[model samples]
Target chain A: MSLIIKDLYARVKDGAEILKGVNLNIPKGEVHAIMGPNGSGKSTLSKVLCGHPDYEVTGGSAEMDGQDLFSLSVDERSRAGLFLAFQYPVEVPGVSNANFMRAALQARLPKEEELDAVAFYKNLRARMKQLGMDPKFTARAVNEGFSGGEKKRNDVLQMMMLDPTYAILDETDSGLDVDALRIVSEGVNAMRAPYRSFLVITHYKRLLDYIRPDVVHVLYNGRIVKTAGYDLVDYIEEHGFDFVKEEHP
Target chain B: MDTPAFNDADELSGKLRLALEQAEAEARLREAETPDRLNEDWRFGRPHIYAKALVSALESDTDNAGRITIQAPAACVEPMADDMRDGEMRLRSIGSDKILALHLKRFGKGICLCIDTVLADPIIITYETEGVFTPSTIILAAEGAAARIIERHIVRGSGLLVATRDIKAMAGADISLELEVSGESTSGSDQPRAMNITNIAAMDAQVRQLTRYSGLDWAREETVAEILHENTTIELFSANRLHGTQILDQHTRQIHSWGKSTSNLLYKNVVDGSATATFAGNIYVAPGAHETDAYQANRNMLLSEDATINSLPGLEILADKVRCSHGSASAPMDEEQLFYLLSRGIPRHDAQMLVADGFLADAVTQFRGSESDGNNTKI
Candidate 1:
């Protein structure tokens, strides 16, 4: 019924600890926003969730509906309904966006089975149109020449296409303008079904204005210090992480 | 041995004599009044490889493989010109004993075809000589008619085979030629040796030629193409994939005789399993050949650590107002690109195969052209 992260501790490299004893949980049909300032380990939490090879989990356990998550590889975790919209999505040259997404989807299909190209393209076109993306964008190389806002929108496009059970949007609004942000939020909100969950990690509350979160958590110094309702975003916007900083200090 | 003079007249004759005598090849040699290499046209950069032959015991029970198909371009005629089949031409059928010979040449305006009608599915023209062997040459001349031809060389068994072909396209006549060669397990248990020379003259005409050699054991090939005329253009592309100790050395020369003439050459080599490849290209622009443009480039990729590639691209210009450029590059696969594919759930070996296939795909793109026929590529 939920994704539970209990007593999580992670390191950037060999012994450079970044996440220390963090705990959070997001039940089905709920949207949670994690707000933290720079250098707070919010990004590390997203990367660790996706099983990035560079980040090592020393002591932690993450489960989705009672199924262990850490045991899966990065791509396996992706196929198993966990998605991470990277803060800075990678630019893969010579690989078109349509082809990359097709490969990812093909990996999830049964062995020796083929993907229906006609149906797949039709679905892709519909999703792209809903996100206000140009039809020609599917043929262009993945993020090779995309602008900052275009890259972020492309990340949202991918999340929408993958349709993961739980999506971790890592700073999805970092590079977006107001118009792009609104379009991305609309795309995300359209996919907000009762069976899906989202953990939106960002610094600003402007994104929460369009896609309201059921709960808000203040993540500071590698741990979630406080949890509140959607009004917590307003409080953070009024002041800052200083209230959480004072209590933690 | 020392390198011969750049303008040696006897080089062609000498090569013909040695090749004809060693392989006992039969072909009528038209003696050029200018002594084949008498002028500066034939020899600009001397191309020679250290010769050595490993004559293995001949196998008596080698299976007979099927025939190889050599593709030639369909005939085309200009708007107001006479058919090229009636032009002056000379045909030569050499090495009919052990080699399936077929030569088509149109220098001025005639069709000359010399075919050894007897088809040898897997032909092997071996070199039995003890010293350096000269490759036989097939001379084709077209007075003014356009011509398209194809020559396929298939080795039934392993044996050292040395051979060459010389084609001349006369003034205002276009000619396109292709050679496809491959080898198999032979009775002799030794690979073939091949030396090929092609001379093309496209005076105010356009010419395109492509050569592909692969699946040879210890095969060595040398190709030389020269373009001579005003407003004439030549598009030359060559690709070779060699395995084992196969060594391929290719040299190309483009001469700009008149103003506004253009030439381009792209040669690629892929070597694996201790194989070696060498590419040498030279572009020459003569004086008064104003507005001449030429480019020569060689790219090689080594598939294994033991494989090696040697490239030398050069340019010589005598004209003050001309554009000419040449370059040579050799490198291994990109490690970052490979890692990225492997990290995406594609197995490491499958990832490597994808990269290798992509590397060779670009070289083959030039060979394909628009076709209205329904037999276009299904892929």
Candidate 2:
């Protein structure tokens, strides 16, 4: 019924510690936002939750609906309904977007079951249209030669297609024009349901205006220092993380 | 009637017999000299061992009945001549001289196809062979004709196949050739090897050639193209996937002998599990071949840490007002690309396969689109 992380500590493999004793709880049916300063481990938390190979958890426990997250592989976490919208989507050459999406959806089926090609294309085209993407993108390589705005849109498109139970938008609003942000926000809003949860991580308050969160937490020095209503966004916008750090100290 | 009492048919037959005998003698002499690692073309492959195996197979009395099959439109199939004159001439004009000589010496009686009109269906020639098999095919496309031809070689057991293909395109003609080589082993120790030599002459025409190799223990392929007239365009592409200690060695040459002609070459290989691949491509522009444009590229994707790839791209331009470029790249699978697919619920092996497929996508696309009109390949 919730994503629970307790005393989570992680570090880059053979490198510096990134997430140190981070704890948070996101229950189903609510959207939570994490606001922090630069180098506050916002992105690392997302990657760690999705089981990126570069980071190793030294001391931590994460459970999705009472199921241990660390026990599964990276891809297993995805099929288990945990999704991360990358800040900078990687460009894959020679693999068409349609084909890539098809492979992903196909993996969810049982070994004896086969995906319906007709229904797949129909659903894909509808989703693409909803996102304002050109029909030609389906045939083009995944994110190859795509603009910044286009890449962000593609990331959202993938999130929509996968339909994970818990989705993390990791700095998804970093590089977007006003129109693109609106469209992407709309796509995220449409996917919200009572059974699903979202963790929106961002630096600016501008994104909160579109996809307002029920709770906003201030993460400073790898720990959640304050939790408040939407008013905390305005206070941080007016002031900054300095006030939060001083209070925690 | 008082002229020399010589029957033209008998005279021509006698001349052909003499020519065959001389060609066979030359081939024997060439085969006597073993190709070792010192030879530039044979350095990466075990040509010395292949040569010995070929010589022994040629000496063996293996019956080759029903080994070759051909399916073509009745009108497009031309009666093959009984003489080896045409095959000998074409073999000498292109391909490695040593390999050509061996082919002539053993299996000189080959098939000849003459295409004079546009055909809707493709002509398929298949060779199923074991032991030592040598086969040659000569294709001549008349003026304004268009055709698509597929030549396939399937090998089993400890098979050794040496193949020669010579293609000629006349003015306004369009031709596409697809050459595929595949092999399987009946026993654990069975080793399958193949050597293919292809030569093309394009005269004010468009010609496309694609060669694909897979499932072979070892293969060596050589292709040479000569642009003989202005407004001629030649495209050459190859895609090979090697795995499990497999080795593929490729050599290509694009000779722009006339002005205002264009030639392009692209070869891609995905090496996995200790496989090895080598490619050497050269673009040669003659002194008077001005306003010529030529390009060559060889790309390799190494899937495993133990996989190896060697690429050498060369350009020798002796002409003014010519544009020529060549490039070679070999690298492991992109980690970022792999993770992108993996994050979407795809397994690690499937993700790697997708990336590898994308790496060689352009070559495959270009080859598949060869017969279509107005082919504008980005590669």
Error of 1 at B294 (Å): 5.3
Off by over 4 Å in 1: A6-22, A39-45, A51-70, A148-154, A174-178, A217-228, A236-249, B1-379
Candidate 1 lDDT tens digits, B1-379: 9854535668867876665553332232232221122322223212112221221111221222223222222122122123221111222211111121221121221123322221212121222321223233333434444444455555545434444454565655555555666565545455555445455556676666677776665443444445566767777777777668777756667777777888878888777778888776778787788888898888877779999787878888988778888888888866654544433444445545555555554455554331011021111
**Looking at model 1, how many pairs of residues clash?**
18
* Tens digits of lDDT, candidate 1, A31-90: 999998888899899888877767899998999878898987666677788887778876
* Residue B222 alpha-carbon offset, candidate 2, angstroms: 0.8
Candidate 2, which segments miss by more than 4 Å at Cα? A245-249, B1-32, B92-96, B108-110, B374-379
C-alpha lDDT score of every prediction, in listed order? 0.64, 0.85
TM-score of chain A of each: 0.98, 0.98
> Highest lDDT, which number?
2
lDDT of 1 at A215: 94
- Candidate 1 at residue A73, lDDT? 68
Model 2 alpha-carbon miss at residue B306, Å? 1.6
Fnat for each model:
0.05, 0.75
